[model samples]
Target: MLRLAPWKVASILAVTFLAVLLLVPSFLGTATVDRLEKLLPSFLPVRPIVLGLDLQGGASLLWEVDSAALTHAQVETLRDDVRGKLREGRISLSGGIAVLPRGVQVRIADAAERAKALPLLRALDQPISNAIIGTAGHMLDITDVGDGSVQLLLTDAAINDKIRRAVTQSIEVLNRRLNESGTKEVNIQQQGVDRILVEVPGLQDTTEVKKLVGATANLEFRLVADPGDPPNEVDNLPQQQGGQIPVQKRVMVAGEDLTNAQTGFDQNSQPDVNFTFNLRGGQRFGQVTSENVQRRFAIVLDGKVISAPVIQTPITGGRGQITGNFTVQEADNLSVLLRAGALPAKLTVVEERTVGPGLGQDSIDAGKRAAIVGGVLVVCYMLATYGIFGVFADVALAVHILFIFASMALIGATLTLPGIAGVVFTIGMAVDSNVLIYERIREEAHMGRSIISALDAGFKRAFATIIDSNVTMFVAAVILYLFGSGPVRGFAVSLGLGILTSVVTAVTMTRMMIALWYRYKRPTKLPI
Candidate 1:
């Protein structure tokens, strides 16, 4: 029919080159692997498929904020604020307490004090919007108290809102930390306002992860007396060594002025943590050190003192180091925590499940089995029905898979069981375009056209139909991707990519093959 064109030969070569460039490096573990993995996808292939947490086996945590406790705490804070204000105003009252859901309430002790208390009470009575309020004569009552004291109630809506915000913030912080930790494919989501789900696939040290999650990273720098220093008063000094000794009090700085922190080894080959401060922090640290040379400053992290070093002189460079007993890993983790900043809300572990790598291996084995069985069956059916054309279709289909895998490896998209299934389905659906074109060719050949003429007519007539069908499916896949989450999106992605690749291979590659065959054999009669 048609001879293989130079452009088709070039295309095949290009695809082969791309497949090797994109996919072959994924099997390599050398120094160039990372560089290759990043560069291959842009010029060569589609995004890579990453394995999901379930397949890789790491840690999944479902955590719910104690909304009731949060509400109670908020109300208590409000109550304390009111109490402090009242005490400052020198007002005396019998009962004025803030409870969850309902705001604060203040009962006037005497009728004479009504005027004084009303304004204060009214000022403090910032209505918890959406809370039911009851008024009986001079008494104001807040109804809907979900938990805690009956002074003010924290509403369900308020708790839900806070939980949502907390979850969002927590995810942001966790992402930052995970990125710094060099972990990939971390999944974090809000199950509800109060609950968060975190999945870290391929993470081994759950204990370390738990530590990072639980840490608040509220760093502080305070002046502490060196245990080896002399007492403030000579008579008050303990003669013994390593006793609590009072060194001159000095304030060098705090971590609030810190802009960044990193882990490094000191000149003496000991583990140390280093931090850089902003202008403000630099200025403060400079002033404090200048004023109190030889005084010790303690670097505190999450309420524990990590190091206390004496100021020998004013450090104007705005950089300092903390030396302590630390392993290389601990130092690195500390640096990561400091750099990632702090979490908005404390993450409490409500549920946790861990999967071992062995299980993940089993899952991979099972997925491979399913894929092989399904693929072989599809190939057999396609070849049986379409004969030589079907075999051509099969070759194109295999190329599609290679391209898909190459794309996935290039992009680092995690592969899951669902994702594997998506790929398998893609293979089965990839033959549709070939089938359409082959059927059209058969019809044209039956109409008594020459082999070459019939092949051309078939491709020309079937192109539009192939486009229309694939376009419709592509649109549906887009919709599915838009509405779907997690695994559903994986399926959409695979199907969408498959459709595009199938069209190209079926119309373009199949035509090239037919041309090459016809040119070689010079077949006067139709193969159909």
Candidate 2:
């Protein structure tokens, strides 16, 4: 019990030394870490903990999804489908086919033909079931408004489900956009039914994020109707020139099938974005170009025609490039948007918060001060209570802290304000573990057990209790991480990891240190 195996001694020391080394980068700034990264070999691990939005002061934005536009678009699509289905069914109507406020309105001038048209239009209604066991509904509610005019509005359940899906898709799109922009440690989560909360750490100017997230970069390839075609005749996209060009409403190839997009310099040294399509997209593009070789195809991005070049030849390879009046940054941004895909609905920034660097620094300083004070008080109390054994425990406590920071850096965790609180809270937890072992030792020694026997009995007796307490706390931390978001998740991460590392250092590392001390000194009495 007094002697540690040679392997055990080496393992404990090696871990402690490595932990100390890992913590150096966390304390140092980015320049120092960057220098070390360049100077050292790739084999050497040298990563710092990424600070979160609360600790480092970045941008926080709350965006609302535009569900109205989604409904309008869906209804427009339904109008086209109804037009096709009615025409195919040889059903004739008298008044006019127009989109009403509630839904598509088809007025039949002939009252006798109204009965025949109603049954055909009712076929447009689709089943809507949000839950597996719940009652399903139709996508459209077809009803006669008045005088043979049938109105079709989206069902309530379907609209609610669409809004939920739109919010979810907006979050996913924002995440991909931030990642593609070389931003790290971003938190994007759905706040409510229609809102998304985004927190980006270490970003000062949120203009780029806002632009990327807000830009409805919905790309589509549409056949040009004619240069003289009016806006009312077809879907018109504004050109870089003064006038607008009418284009076919039907999409030739969607941006969703674009597998990759990269910024590259054109042959004339102008910045352009090259995009590649997947198999289905490639086939569609090939067919479209082959069928309309001499016609001009418009590359429409966000309802604007960026380019309208003649299809000189069939592009069967699925590779194409967009050449426009674009700067390097604009080309790169477009590539990012194209690669990340488009959001499901437009996003409106309903709320925004930007944290300054000075504030973040102040928070970091306050956290440091609290940790120092707490650590000092803990060390002082431990030493005052059990003398040399307390000193050993204090040493273990420091090592435990080092392990926490080291693990966090290793996993690239974002250290937020709540995470710092978790670390501070862990300082006390470390002291508690030592107190448990020390008090158990004192109780054993008072029972008249020999010093060596008492020390061994103390650790063995307290093992189960220590395990139970740490396990329960660890489980709670896991629950926090699973259910929470942003700062709460950061706190959970630090706390959970701190508990595991503290337990190891508290029990195993402290035991090893005591065993080494006993082996060297041959002590007659235990310090506790």
The alpha-carbon RMSD values of the candidates against the true structure, listed in the order shown, are 10.7, 9.1
Report every candidate's CA lDDT.
Answer: 0.69, 0.83
Q: Write the per-residue lDDT of candidate 1 for residues 309-335, one digit (tens) a residue.
A: 787888878888877688766787787
List TM-scores for all candidates, in order. 0.57, 0.64
**lDDT for each residue of candidate 2 in 164-219, tens digit (9 for 90 to 100):** 88888777777677754221458788887889988788766789888988887789
In Å, residue 478's CA in model 2 sits off its true spot by: 1.0
Native-to-model Cα distance after best TM-score fit, residue 380 in candidate 1, in Å: 2.4
Candidate 1 regions with alpha-carbon error over 4 angstroms: 1-8, 28-49, 61-161, 168-195, 205-354, 357-367
**Residue 405 lDDT in model 2?**
86
Candidate with best lDDT: 2
Q: Give me the candidate number with maximum TM-score.
A: 2
Model 2 pairs in collision: 103-152
